[model samples]
Target: MNEPISWVVAYPEIFLLVMSAVISLVDVGVKSRLRDTTYVLSLLTLAVVAYLLGASAASGETLRSFNNMVVSDPMGQWLKCFAALAMFATLVYGRRYAGDRDMLARGGEMFSLALYALLGMFVMISGHNFLVIYLGLELLTLSSYALVALRRDDPQAIEAAMKYFVLGALASGFLLYGMSMVYGATGSLDLAEVLKAIAGGEATLKGSAQVLVLGLVFVVAGLAFKLGVVPFHMWVPDVYHGAPTAITLMIGGAPKLAAFAIVIRLLVEGLLPLAVDWQQMLAVLSVVSLLVGNLAAIAQTNLKRMLAFSTISQMGFMLLGLLAGVVAGDSGNMANAYSSSMFYVITYVLTTLGTFGVILLLSRNGFESENITDLAGLNQRSPLYAGVMAICMFSLAGVPPLVGFYAKLSVLQALLASSHPLYIGLAVFAVMMSLVGAFYYLRLVKVMYFDAPTQTADIVAGADARSVLSLNGALVLVLGIVPGGLMTLCAQAIAALLA
Candidate 1:
């Protein structure tokens, strides 16, 4: 089996790599006063990638390459498109912040790093072999570490980077150990082969099932850390709060799409035989994350910290989809549940991007825009800002007619349809916890719209920030009003994966 020479299949990753190189060269060689060049380049790169992804989707051919180490199907294509869109939004949101802070001198580096991270994402989405998956994971993890330390002068940034690096290394170790154990047990590196082996008497190997289960536990633990699930999520709050707000926005948004894809590949494709074991583990983790994330967020005064906890809770909801997809007997429901999970991830990216956009807009030099108090009397000071923030708050609260509401509803629907009584119980608990989550989001709305302005401070929002914020904020409403298009596409992607 030789690798396929499918130019169209490789176009998206090729474009990203080329654009990243060109942008880096331009940054190093060109001495221009206009800081917007990097921003423009990033936007152009994103547009090109999105166009290529769309073309690939329209072609409707699943392309596998590198001797089947990589697989490009509808699901991968759609997720890559979403990732590109999210990256574009992050660039737009970060533009003003980067420029105003004179960070554009390094903007090319940021864009390059982001593209590299995106490369990892693409690899993760398309990977069919454990080697490919681990390679992609390392690329993403390393690039992210560099990105967190982009602001070298800030001690807080350095501290956050160090923390992220250390924890990420541990997670990688766990993932590697699991991979080794799986290889030892099954004598295969390809996901499909691993599954076939397990199904065809490989389970009879001496203690193979136990070893495989333990290996999977480690693998999930590592991935769960990336997802910010409970017990493995301690780094989230500190990193979110300490890193630059723009970086925080990036972390909170697009990465989830890639993470979700990786989970599906590893758990659904590679470890399907052990679904019963992992499903139970995920159920417990999901329940804990939901309870702890919501309850802990209530005590948080720092805006970023609160959002960090919120991210953890959101992961729990995502896990519900995974749980539903891993039922003991009914594989049909599992497929539908995976589709639901896909929908949930899409909704999450939109809602989180919009939420962080508001934070970026209000943030200024010397002020992180991180405290709930920063939003005080925002309605009195700037009704537009107040209204945008309120919409984000409502969406995050899972209020009706908004994107977040649909996301939560979809996941819960998947959970409810599961045959497991405990899964249903957990779903019910998630709904109640969501109600509690609403209180804090509402509190922010109250501060923004009802409270009095403590002091009139000059808010300096640059053009890039303003443009991205307006677009991001409007997206929440637009998606809420007419979600059918994206939802239909998501359904299609999910259907393809199961097919």
Candidate 2:
């Protein structure tokens, strides 16, 4: 008989699976009045997985288990750590909002779905093949769709879920079709082998190159839909605005890191040899996303919708580094570019979490936190909360002495150093768009400090909300002040992947 495999190798996924199962069982069998149990368990699961990730990193052992379907590598380790951290922050800011609105009754389902989604994200980060990527993507997507419709009673939530489900299905279909084409062309699902085949000119089938390129286009489109990139981002505003605040926080925060990981694996790992083709494609997408995402967001009065569009614009900025990686092949610039992209992802998660935390603090039941006017008297009511919100808005706008500024600076620097004039032009445009984005962010600040209260006199700030919001808000400033450490870690993780 074969010896049992060590469970430690698959610890990340295993932890989530165990927690999810236990939560599900408890929900079924146990009659608990405290609906927060599942949410607490979900948070604990993230903490445990985060510890495991740290231990794995400390051990410094790169292990491929289960016939190499999953591997523990530096890149995967770092991403898992980031994902866990983001999830934890999301849960912290979300639980109270859910509880207050009576959204906690079925909160266990949401938490379990989040865990499943996280398991998929973990698989995605460690994936070495197309099959694994697809499995992870599907798991993540399916769970997310359910989470969007958590409040089934609400018409808007149901509508958003419907839109999301239909659009997500179409994207998945395209992605699967593309994966099939790539498999046909390369005769292997393994990303390493596919890369080798492409490098060796072994991908020669009837229209193999075209098929592969078409497949890549479809894959990018599908992933872009997840990233909320412009033209593919129609679902974002509606979904963010309609979904519960807790769900919005989860969707906006952790999943973006997972999407970034998937992009790195698929584009950088799987299609590296086709750099010239995909680089230009990403460049165009990046430009369009930046221009359209920023311009459209400026017109949005709904806070969540604005942030949704802002997320799209941010994805465009993140793509700059990815494009640079491909465009600067063999010059070692790709490594730097990849690092910059990772750095940007981390910074963006922090800023987004803090921004949403503020929203949660201000919002009460029956009142959706969806307007800039809602923040008018925030400074007068709670100066600390207002200050934190200011920092988050500034960071999102790419202001100096903040983490977001460095993220933008690094990506633009990478783009400027690349040989492509078009990339340089787009980078400049993105910078200009950042300035354009700043106007709205600053407008919020003006409302917070200068404008008098317009919405309501009774500003409710719960204790749990204030604590999380304060920490989340301060983190933006703290990270901005001492970004070198995280930046170094991101650089190292990217370097390991490239190595």
Candidate 3:
């Protein structure tokens, strides 16, 4: 008999969908009465969804629904919870910034669209079917494109949106074509069935192997664009520089966790048999990203653009953990390797949230804080904000006693444990690139601390943003000091995924 379908497995997504629609309608009615009402409602919605995810994670049981197209598991639940929390923190940092710039003046569209994007991320995390995953990806990307152009009056924002849309559509096409090829090769869209076909051995020696490999190439290309790695990273700097600071934070922060989840789901879960092929490709990509991303970032004067390049290099470190997962086809180290990547991604996102949060906090109406020179003498203006930004920069530089250090160390450990000469060399190169990257981050710190104030205007930010920014920085430090718990959790989640 077929297994009974359970809608309860998708309760969090269902709730978010319904609440998002309700909030959209409610915004039309109550937005004029109270300017911040929709914001409060959006926060409450995220809080409830987070609670549901937490409860499910605590249950420690995987549940599937809709013919296993949707799954509820510890990995998905935890990622979803964090994604929501990141969105919450993003809104907290963005509200005042948005209000001053007239982005939040009309209604709750900004909040609702963000909620929709969160809903898309949740679906992406839980989706077990290729079609479902694609659907979720479209939802997220479309929302992102719209969010980027929210400031329609700005030519830069509109131009950025056009570039994003054109490139995004092409990437989607690449992914879809790849998916079609995979389906043709395996005669199944279901990942498990495709795996069975590949593992069964008849498919590899046949004519289908070539097609499968070709499809894999396109898929990886599409994914690399999303990850903003070098050679596929042209859009990142433009988008980051063009969009408003608030939208930039939204784009940079939580979506990365979603990207990591999809990579795990599609590559690691669905296509492990082809690791040798993709591993080589990823090795090249990682090296190029580290080299180009770090070198390019050093020349950028715009803080947003510089961070965009920084993100590309950081993704290289995350890829190192991924490539370490399969050495000589020995699957014994897969869980630890993948878990390290997960931990790296999560920590990177956490650090990114705080870093961008500080940027947003420093911004005010009519004055965009896009230039690194704008940060001159930040310490003199607001010591607390400057300190938070410093912590974020230090963490990103992999300085000792910060979460980024531990995150990078874990990935390097995974690479070293592989006992491969090539990987060992790559790790050494990564360390060197990191040292180069540190010069820029530390240079920014020097400007904030030692340089004279460029803008004598007083910096004003609310209590909520200040408090959350402090906590965000503290977590980065605390997690570095005691990373055992999060590391174990990531390991357990990856183990469950493999099982």
Candidate 4:
């Protein structure tokens, strides 16, 4: 008898896929420069998908579908749920901005492409096999390249897209080469089978241990590139700087959750048997990312570029949690450590949304808010937007009582809680990096508050964008104050992953 493939386990991906095609078709008939029709439909699609993922997560059932090539688990579901909501918010904040820049003048391609990119992220999060994961990643990256080049008339956008495409292709090649080697060693493409092959010493006994290790290095290198960590993060600043601000958010925001998902799926779930080897590798990446990201950010006049480096440093801190998960070969601290990283990523995304929302709001027709000085006297123009931006800045700075502080605290706690000398030392080093990072974040705040307004034009935003932006900022503050609910959710989701 043939094995049955469970199609129902991937309800959200199915819905998203179907809706993306439908939306694309529907967009062909859309003539509005604002893309209102496609925008509304896309929002509805994202909302429904998010609901489905949330409902599935709430059910707490782990199911393998498509002959075990796809898995629906709490960890995946929660991440998918968040990614969907982040997409929804991105559209909300970027809709008017895109329309203003003629991004929607031709059709609703941006909206549809965004949905496609999100579909890619969904696949990435839910994929249970090496091929599936790589396919998902390609889908997301390819869509992103097109999205970056959407402003075909802009030379900078085209240049950035070219850079992104070239680097992204190289990274994909690294991952594929690594996957092939891994397959040669383990004789399996399925993550579970790969895990069994490695953990059971099948590869070692077959004299493929060295090959597996070499493959792991390439895999980690590919993953590091995807995560935009140091040494592999060349594309981050240029892409963030060159792309339209709205496109920047699309690239920077939700894909992070998906990136985190793949790290877990590939490293934590598949090759955890070799934690000791990967652990040291991750530690070095983390330390270098913190050093380079923070220091380089200090020299940036472009807000987008600064945030890009900030992202690199923030990811470094999250990686620290992953490294601390395995201490002296004892898996006792695994759940807490990974959960802390999860918490950090979620909170970071939430803050990024708010920060970018403000930037989008401040930008008017013929004016792009791309520089630090663009925020000067923002408080005078609109206190609400200023407050939102300030909150985001403070959160990103890891200032007290904000969600970012707690996010950093949780990661530091995970590191220290491991009771390993190296991890403890990392905790200290991370703290020092955060202090260095604060200077840039606070510098923006100072400009927003103290400097004179360069333009007296009224700050205008649609009702939807304003409401959502406010809510986004409020959540950052509220979550910081009461983080237990999210913390518990992350812990349970990670626990489910381990189980």
lDDT of 4 by residue, 296-405 (tens): 99999999999999999999988999998889989999999999999999999999999999999889899998899888998998999989999999999999889999
**Against the hidden reference, what TM-scores do the models get?**
0.96, 0.95, 0.98, 0.99
Quick one: best lDDT, which candidate? Answer: 4
Superposition-based RMSD of candidate 3 using all C-alpha atoms, in angstroms: 1.2
Error of 4 at 36 (Å): 0.9
In terms of lDDT, the poorest run of 10 residues in model 4 is 1-10
- Candidate order by TM-score, decreasing, is 4, 3, 1, 2
Cα lDDT tens digits, model 2, 440-496, are 789889989999987665656656557767877777888888989888888877777
Off by over 4 Å in 2: 1-7, 29-34, 58-60, 205-207, 455-464
How many Å off is the CA of 328 in candidate 2? Answer: 6.4
Task: Score candidate 4 by lDDT.
Answer: 0.94
| Best of the two (2, 3) by lDDT | 3
Model 3: ten consecutive residues of lowest lDDT: 28-37
Clashes of 4: 0
| Pairs of residues clashing in candidate 1 | none
